[model samples]
Target: MTQVKKHEAKLSRAVESIQPSGIRRFFDMASSMENIISLGVGEPDFTTPWSVREASIHSLESGRTSYTANAGLIELREAISDYMEERFDVSYRPEDEVIVTVGASEGIDIALRSVVDPGDDVLIVEPCFVSYAPLVSMAGGQPIPVPTFMKDDFQVTLETLQEKITPKTKAIMLSFPNNPTGGVMGREDLEKLRDFIIEHDLVVLSDEIYAELSYDQEHVSTAAIDGLKERTILISGFSKSFAMTGWRVGYVCAPAAYAAAMLKIHQYAMMCASTMAQYAALEALTNGRQEMEEMITSYRQRRNFFVKSLREAGLSCHTPGGAFYAFPSIKASGLSSEQFAEQLLLEQHVAVVPGHVFGEGGEGHIRCSYAASMAQLEEAVDRIAVFMNTIKKEG
Candidate 1:
């Protein structure tokens, strides 16, 4: 008698092929060690504003503990619509063009799934958020990296974008006031991209999660560009800007058709964003501006101090224009990005993410978040300086 064969369960190829987030891996490693000063994650260090938290508490006390509409709370959608228009001059019909998401992350996932078909190519500006390429792959699209450089202020150029475009290219994902590098695109930089995107007929998935944190210049929405609004899927949330990371509230604004497509997916996968969270988000939009602005001011000060400190510590760093990160080149240390980060963490108890994990154009550099307190930033830099000196002595 033949023995019965044992069945082995298998994950879908899509899920199986994806790697865990590099940012989380380092953060976890650092968490296990004592006295580790982690600059790995890109979360704000501030607590959620009092009014926003109070709104959520009130909702809970009022027994409003239920799921919202699949498209989210109409009140929150209207608030998001107003906030977008007033702040960025981009308007969307709240009724059908805005969908609140579990997070900006979910908005990105649904947006990619809504537009991408198998084998389609999505151009991602490199040294960007770690999730973009993986999300594209999960959506059955090919993620093609378009490298941006520090010399170019990490802004994608028409020429660079053209080099990566193919007939199969379906969309381009952009994040201004970018993560990791903290590079921001000015109007001129975006205008150069506009003609190229129009020529290629590409959908634009513009991740503006860090828009409100921009310094030196105003954050320009890609949808605010003259001809790009119709094709741009704007994804942002209260997490970064309002220090509401734990609140898990974000939203996507797009053309009615695109919004509907994403909403259908959101309906099946996630019935709605949390009811309490939506109330919190509404309060955030209504009255959280002053506190948000104060946080932005603090981040700008941290950026200046951290960038200066990194440079004085002997790393060549491009002063980031937005976000609370400084990507400093570690090439002079005769070490790869991973090596430098590892040695720095092990020796000095300071944890930063290695740049190469952020994809092309990230090698030989390290991403240090300045979202910690000033005292922590000061101590981290001193430790970094000591680490750099040890490398010099060893060399």
Candidate 2:
């Protein structure tokens, strides 16, 4: 009989440090029970609207089901280029600058893997996406978490960037119109980051997947900055805004050389995004703008309700200018973020993610995604308020 070697006893540290998302725990628990209304998920509740779905059906019917070019279909890439230019005022050559990916998920992983050598320092602004740090670690780069201030509305400042920067720094992960906090960084912040990256010659990985979700202002693309365009990799997809998460379509746009380099890695790792999905994404870009507007409008209504009700429920909530999440402080409950989330689930039958699940600066908050229906939100709000009142009385 062969014995397993000690070095191969289990997973590597990189694999081990990359834990499963904390938000999924509630999902597992909820699936076991019926009648559990959850606002914990960070996605649009809408399905891929009819037009986009029809595109995929049409493609499959026409025998467009074969593997596409490793970088993705040219039509989809061109659509992405045109979409970016018309929406965010950013321009890139489709043939050279774009690579279609499995989703923004694959775009992120490939972009990091293509550039990160062992022990390279990657700066991540917190409280950010859970995937960024772990993905960096997986690629053998040291993940450095840079704290974004809640008081400052979770904007990543030049000051924080300066403090976290060192000679080993290779890249910074930017998730604007950010998740969890629902924070949006304006043109000023984008300009500051662009300038700093130029001075340091640092690479910028800007995740604009949530760009279409902004409420109070138009989303800014960091790649729009002059020389910074050469160093920035813009990762976006049709998932969030177009209700196409199940389609698993996204693309990365970068400088031609870098895009080429990343495409090599992506080819080996992913091969190609789903052909039907890419076709669906083409229709999404070509005709999904109206669908996106409808989703955004619904999110804005949901966001307003959640924000107003959350504060009235005794949580100090930030009225986010973008995204469909509310980063409400649960500090008043005298419980840590995890404790607050657990108790809320147990007693109130409501599930929310602990902010600390994202990173260090998120310790005292809970993230509630308002992407659910208004009726579900109202009930959750009532239950949350009653739960808080019960706790306050006990205290």
Candidate 3:
């Protein structure tokens, strides 16, 4: 009469507190239907560039297949070091300051793990990449979310950061050219944050995966600010820039002590990323700059087209300064983000991610990826306009 599930009883309370992801519910629905033009995923629509792929194939052809050092191959790490210096004016020693990670995802996980012990509070900017909190929680930290609103261009405020800080806070996780909202924090903005970090004596996890996609201004590294280098973990990768998502290569740059400690975690948990992929990423750093430039240019064109189209469709579109997403309010549509996305998919055959997938603060907003072709974006705009006008007329 009492057959307990094999794993149910032993499951920790920490594991149970996590919920199924909000972003996935919309995805599951969007996927099963045909004629759905998905502007949901943030991935580049392009394939990985030719040169990088060649490097991977070359590695395999030469039988360079084996486990790499847990921190990764030294050659690839050196390439990354040089690339960061040349591109962002950020410098780090290859031997101590960097660790090659599986993706920015792993960099995020290991970075949070390094500083957050049980009950340490992590401050996260709201409407961010959804994974940050769950990763923090899994690593035994609590996330303290600071909400940023549309009126403010969704930028985190110095005042808000000051208000949220407490004695228990360990770190603040930042994502610029951010997910969902597509907001960016320029140099002046990051300087304010750096000053706050020094005053509060806090750690910072800077997720700059979308750094390459900034349209209006240059991507600034938090570590580039003078005093913040020791305290900031810079997370970036080859995914967005070089169309290398499936390659699963990313890295983190921090001080030597942090790198060494994270290497132990990486060794035990992941061992290393794919060796061939690391070789490909090495090629990306050394040779794929032109490809990265071209994609960023295309995204800028797409960003301009889609923002205007979204406004023409009657949604209040905030021009995302970077990244391929436009986060527009669906408040006038009389639908919550989840409802709006479902109806858009069901009626107009367009797929967009509901903004609440990022957090509660995103309830009335929707994230549309403009990485699709021009034709699809036009059709999506037309469909959305009709849907809104019909709803208005009905009311």
What are the lDDT scores of the predictions, listed in order? 0.93, 0.89, 0.90
Q: Can you tell me which runs of candidate 2 are displaced by over 4 Å?
A: 1-10
lDDT digits (tens) for residues 1-395 of candidate 2? 99986774666877876779887887777667666778788788998889989989999999988999998898888888888999999998999999999989999998998889998999998998889988899899998999987788989988989999999999999998888899888887788777789888899999999998999989988898778888999999888989888888888999998899899998888899999999999998888889799989999998898899999999998788787899999999999998888888888788888899899889999988898999999999999999999989999
Q: How many residue pairs collide in each prediction?
A: 0, 0, 0
Output the number of the lDDT-best candidate: 1
**Model 3: per-residue lDDT, tens digit, 68-127?**
988889998898898889878899999888899999999999999888999999999999
Q: List the residue pairs that clash in candidate 1.
A: none
TM-score of each prediction: 0.98, 0.96, 0.97
lDDT of 3 at 290: 90
lDDT tens string, model 1, 1-395?
Answer: 99999999878998899989777777777888999888887899999999999999999999999878899999999999999999999999999999999999999999999999999999999998999999999899999999988888788888888899999999999998998899999887898888899998999999999999899999999999999999999999999999999889899999999999999999999999999999999999999999999999999999899999989999999989888889999999999998899889889999999999999689988999999999999999999999999999989
Order of quality (TM-score): 1, 3, 2
Better of 2 and 3 by lDDT: 3
Q: Model 2 misses residue 244 by how many Å?
A: 0.6
Better of 1 and 3 by lDDT: 1
Against the true structure, candidate 2 reaches a TM-score of 0.96
Ranking by lDDT: 1, 3, 2
Candidate 1 local lDDT, residue 325: 89
Clashes of 2: 0
